[model samples]
Target: MSKSESALALPSRRALFKSRLNNRTLMRQVIARQESRRSRNLSDAAELPPFAVRVLTRMGFGPRRTELAPQSAPNPNQVFSDQFQRSPLLGKDDVAYFESLGRNDDERLERYVDEQLYGNLPDPEWEQRKAAYPASFDTLDEPLSTTYSERECQGFSNYVVPQRQVERAAFARACYSRRQLLELIVDFWHNHFNVFSGGDEDIYVSWAHWDRAVIREHAFGNFHDLVQATAKHPAMLHYLDNYANEAGGFNENYARELFELHTLGAINYLGNTSPLDAPLLAANPYSGLNDPLLDALNISDPARDIQSHYTDNDVYEAAKALTGWRYDDEDIRDENNVCTSGGTGAFFVNEADHDSGGKVILSGGLQNIPADRGALEDGEVAIKLAVYHPGTARYIALKLCQRLIADEPPESVIQAAADTFYANRTEPDQIARTLRTILLSDEFKDPANWGKKIKRPFEYAVSAMRAAQCDYTWRFDDRDTDNFLRTYEGTGQRLYWWRTPDGYADDRAAWMGSTTLVQNWRTVDWLLDENDDSDADRVMRIIDTTLENFPGNPTPRELVAFWCHWILGFTPSGGWVGDVGTYYAHEPTALGRACMQFITQQDFNGEEDSPPFPADQQIPREELRNDDWPNRWHRRLRGMVKLILWSPNFMQR
Candidate 1:
């Protein structure tokens, strides 16, 4: 088989994680979780009915409570496909408020979702709010430095504050955007063309420039446009240390990742070794000879033994090709080291910093542009060559298919998607067209692949908030937004803060650790006001408000059932509704206490107190065991939301 075929055949990060679930430690942890919730609450082993769950979980931020409702459409696929035929822009979901005009109207669901797909949706309230907010969506046309303060940092307050504003808007879009797929695509491109936000204190000034102008602007536009835009974007220029890449010395950081992570993928990169490095490897260097990633991660077979499509010399040549690409505002000394500001600048090439050399790329194509003319032409040519290569199509297609379908997606689907990509190489909607093929394919909608993908921390947090209809406020003035981001501190995905060029891994194994379990459970505060620490009122408001949004006035059992239907997108296990309904029959506080202990205080092992008996059987709430039954029932309802939120089933979507 071919190299691409060999790579695709390899077991993915999910398969690796699945294999490890059988390990003694993981097995014991699962068992302990089961034992703790011994009131017959099955762990992830709980069966969910087919067709109830939607593939939108992988496509967007998962389905909301309303989305989980029985669709009025007789054929759901037709309604879903009608929306995709149009183009998509960014969503205008306010992170602080769940309300969007017509979002709650059952009849306008497809119409609303369709309009957002093309960015044709009218969000009058959002427009008004944008006019009032200082975050300047106008950065799409200019540099972020110019939009914010061009002045130097004073304790980084100005930089961070505006950056936080952009971040809040981004989070809001993820949580409430009608254009879920569009936001998801933008996120994919952002990570693909990632520039760490925390690297240089000054970088925050250029954050929106990169996000708005480069990534988001060209997200659905074209493959060539996106690559070229990111390669020249100031945030990326500085992040990869390409700004310092001069004629005498070259940094292969950006060029290497451009091939390894962005376009060709690590499987095709072949490392920094070339025929010239044969002498170095044969002589034995001072450091570890074996690949650290291969060993430490324990990847076997084909993935461990990948064929190199390009070598280190090619990366060096690529860096030389990209030389002199720098932003304005850089200090320049014309002669005698006299420094003067170039002022706030756009992308431009400096001939003095460029390496005037003929180079051979991976395809053995000669790039011999004369130094006297076309200084920036070779870099552009090189990017075009890389993007159009057959490997790039396959690699990029695999990722698109992986993120949309299962981690170990079927080879048939990948080949089909890659075909679409190559066929639409010059089209404006190249990536979108490719995604459309994969998304609408039988592979994506197949029952086998429904929950195959795992939810990253960002997806989890946003989906939970979306389902709960969270009235979150990330305003710096209130400090809630700071706390929101902090909650993601050690979690799976921290938006825009990754320092490395590889960006965040799509691999679920990279995230599913023991400690992350508790953290994931603790983050259910978005669902209910339990963590609000208020004496009263918030719980009742949350419970009452959430129930009111649903169809009928549901009792405790029916409420639990509706939530199970909404949150899990399926019915609960056999005894679940009865357990919740019977226990929360009158005073819901008992249900609250049960779920909190099951979630908040639970850990990896059964090293704590014995499991509590069924509330209906032992210590009924009528006695008000330790607290007033009537007073605390609202608190118990909060606990119910938490229980559903923290379930392993919810973790998958």
Candidate 2:
């Protein structure tokens, strides 16, 4: 039934020869057949693509960290997150008190509004408030001034801390649980409806809610409603400056992004990975002047006479219909000048500030506005109208399909997801179901797509730590090391705070550069070294358990290739081990032993690019190349680990 069993079934040579004396030719044919079969089996091992091997290792709880995930049948990310979910934030009473203070009971709600605008009103002038909240701090480099180094700036800022924590917890869950699908979902949703953590007041606070409320809530839901919900979110409002928009102060930042960044990006075909050389239009209306239609959408645009489906004037008119909105703050006084206890922390509508008369939208044309519309209700309607546009479905569908399927998804995938979006209408949960259909579809599981995607830094870093079985106790209070993690949050990959409202670049071309490769390699080295520092025994245990049957009796070259595939997800091309293999051939057993030491030496973190092994380790000197093979084997194995760390595969994913 199996190879080992069949081998045992073979008769002894003396008995076999005697029995087969009259059938020598038959015995010869059987021997030849056995030899051929062995060759085929060995070749099969080599045929597995490096990428596939890497993908399996990184995506699944493979041998190295199987304990983290018990080969469970269902979701991986969920199992992982559940394992580490905050144990209800101990001291429930304190948390409850804070939460209760922000609760929206009717009396507290009215009082809260009163306090936000008027309670702290300086007697002489409200001019300071208006000055502090300028109409436009439009340039990318303006408004926010920073003198700290990248690392230092990241340390002090509380922005993006929540997301970093959430992502790490999700990663830990994946590494330590059987639910692989859950990790995939977290990544999918986070990317699908991406939001930057840095921005103005409402957005700054609202981003806290968006991570779980908007993105995670509808992660597995329908794409349409996810877009719509995000559009309504104050974080989106603040980030896109929609709250700044007024009846005459039209800003298309939100509207344009509703199309470009959120739903259907500028590129027409789904998941096309081509670099956009054309002027990059903003995902929100306020991205910049690169777009003619968008430039016209700016509140200050003078071309008021231009006739078009969607124009700056229309955006301005829309903004006017949705003005006077402010966030709910416990310490804040309302416009009427009273201290308040509770209200929703969002853009509030000021009836006086809103120009609620009927207006014309370029795309929808002359829509009648309700006469009694208030800021909150009017803004909600505007967001709804923007999200329900015909183009919105197509835009959202393509993005959802891309996140679930491929960077280059098929037309069918887009169509299917889009159809689901349309059917689900405005329900976020329904949209998640549509996404689940795409994630669990035949197309998603195809072999051609196996490892087709590259690991984002979030995936790469967390997976590497998991592979090494590193234990991390990340705490928000631990500012020193917390700073390092925070620096990497959404800043690396050039997605730094205040960089662009359009969000991070999400394709291969955007990520695969020499700088990124170097950074990745350095990061890998740091993590490996950290793993060694944290728990050397645990690291060793993971290696032993993970590579139990690696390459079966592999040659030196095969061993090198195997390590690459197991860790980095790619086999080194032939040149990588050509010389090493030649040396290894002289004493296969000895060279094989060297691999273990090589893996251990990866503990060195100081200079990531420098080779970790001693020069003597790479080549066997005559004195060390003795027939007493065990010692020589140890030396050779030491070299293998260094080479493994330095291999190209480690640099990529």
Candidate 3:
């Protein structure tokens, strides 16, 4: 048979086994030789390759990858010779603009909160304040203690304060950051203990509570403690309607998501294994060996399968358990003629609303659990029961490792991390130790894994701004108008603009389409020249300041080529340059000389002194002209930049 046909043939089972054995034998020999060499009391020290370092950084948190070519390494000032930091991309002035906006946001949030607490405008210029920070919708003649309006105070109560603080805390940690790993942990925990900002009044306070009590306190702590805090937090209680859980009404939203999303992945028949196969069938979905007994718990269905089984009843039970715990409304008044009911911030468990009969919780923790602690004190016992489960440890460890390493982390790595979690059950902060072990492991910084994650819209936008040094702000007076747009953060045009609860999709295929490609090209145009209102010399200086060690090649032809290289990071091959040149070859280099020939025929922008097209070239005047000369010329430049941005090289760290 021909070599190709032989290669395509499937190997026999014996041949496959032989191949695996050979690979294992080779690896073992390499390790044994390395160990023997090290026995002379010498350390086997090897610096990570440059590409590996870049990959490691991207794996943790996406950053712009510099040129990985060894000869293109950056100099002492920390810039590459071939690259110019200056771009029609972001510039130095943009950083100042964004930072200024950040400061203004801080001031606005402070004033808005102060005004809400004291029952009066915090500033004497309150009307001007109304003008400056107009509410999205008009308030009633007087505002109610509880409001669902898109008003600034309530909006502040919802999206702004907690987000700003979380963002600021995260940004601060990013700036001059020492604890690199903590930032990754915060991201993991934030997604893990997600709170829908638009949930309710209590969520305003509870949002902050989850961040402070659950995510932040134990972000690097033990998985057990993190889950416990999340289960008990007032924000989670209200967000998931857990506060409303009671005997007659069980809201299993918390319970269901806690398992399917937060803890153990749902059990199902493997795609390869037939469901009818008894040997392949695992444990019952409803009950892991450790599920709690609900006889004393008084659930809607006492014998209900509250285990891993995802029945319609499970969601109901999950939602019901979260009932009755609600926010203290500032407007609520008691019969004694006083507004005494709503204390506002704390998690209040009302006895009248609680299901007091005993409930057994079935969890994987059955081996060591102290049994259902009998009729519990409202939410406290339930919270503890949810948090202290063994499944929480494994679930949390898996998530942390996934974020730091890969989504499908090695079973050994997860087990090691989970072991750390189990060992430190009492001190919930042990989760961080497990994470550190994972991140610092050889598997995490692997070359094959570099630049593997598709950047989410927000990460894409932020990383682009940081990379290009773009200096723009979304700080217009009517801020809520911009929040939706801000979701697209990298490329100016908003991304998918998703309205669903799933947040944004996390795959590259979602962004790789013709429309997005056109949008990306448009952004490159805007970054390069459309936003070029500032002086050209000033713009160049901003480029010099931001891009390090540019000008890798000093020749005239190479200078233009090098600019493309720094901006695009890859050298254009002959075929590529020929493609761009094919469009422009018909045109003369000089406008003055060319305009002499075609000045009367060319149209110009309305400005009286606006220049006309080059005389020697035929410019398409508003006919769908992708193929015509001038448009093609524009496309050549814009295309190179766009290709750079869209190319896999630009997609890396």
Candidate 1 per-residue C-alpha lDDT over 203-279 given as tens digits, one digit per residue, 9 for 90 to 100: 67677666777777787678878898888876788889887787788888888888887777776655556634322
Model 3 ranges off by over 4 Å: 1-56, 63-180, 201-214, 267-323, 332-343, 363-390, 471-530, 535-642
TM-score leader: 1
lDDT of each: 0.56, 0.42, 0.39
Q: For this target, which candidate reaches the highest lDDT against the unseen true structure?
A: 1
- Give stretches of model 1 more than 4 Å off: 1-44, 49-52, 65-119, 123-145, 148-155, 271-308, 330-342, 365-373, 530-541, 546-555, 570-631
Query: TM-score of the candidate numbered 2?
Result: 0.56
Cα displacement (angstroms), candidate 1, residue 382, comes to 1.6
RMSD of 2: 18.9
Candidate 1's displacement at residue 617, Å, is 14
**For model 2, what is the alpha-carbon lDDT of residue 44?**
23
Superposed on all Cα atoms, the candidates' RMSDs to the truth, in angstroms, are 12.5, 18.9, 17.4
Off by over 4 Å in 2: 1-64, 67-194, 200-207, 222-225, 264-317, 330-347, 362-364, 368-372, 426-428, 450-452, 483-491, 494-498, 531-653
- What tens-digit string does per-residue lDDT give for candidate 2 at 462-542? 556554445443333344335436444532642224346555555545544444444544454444333332223322233
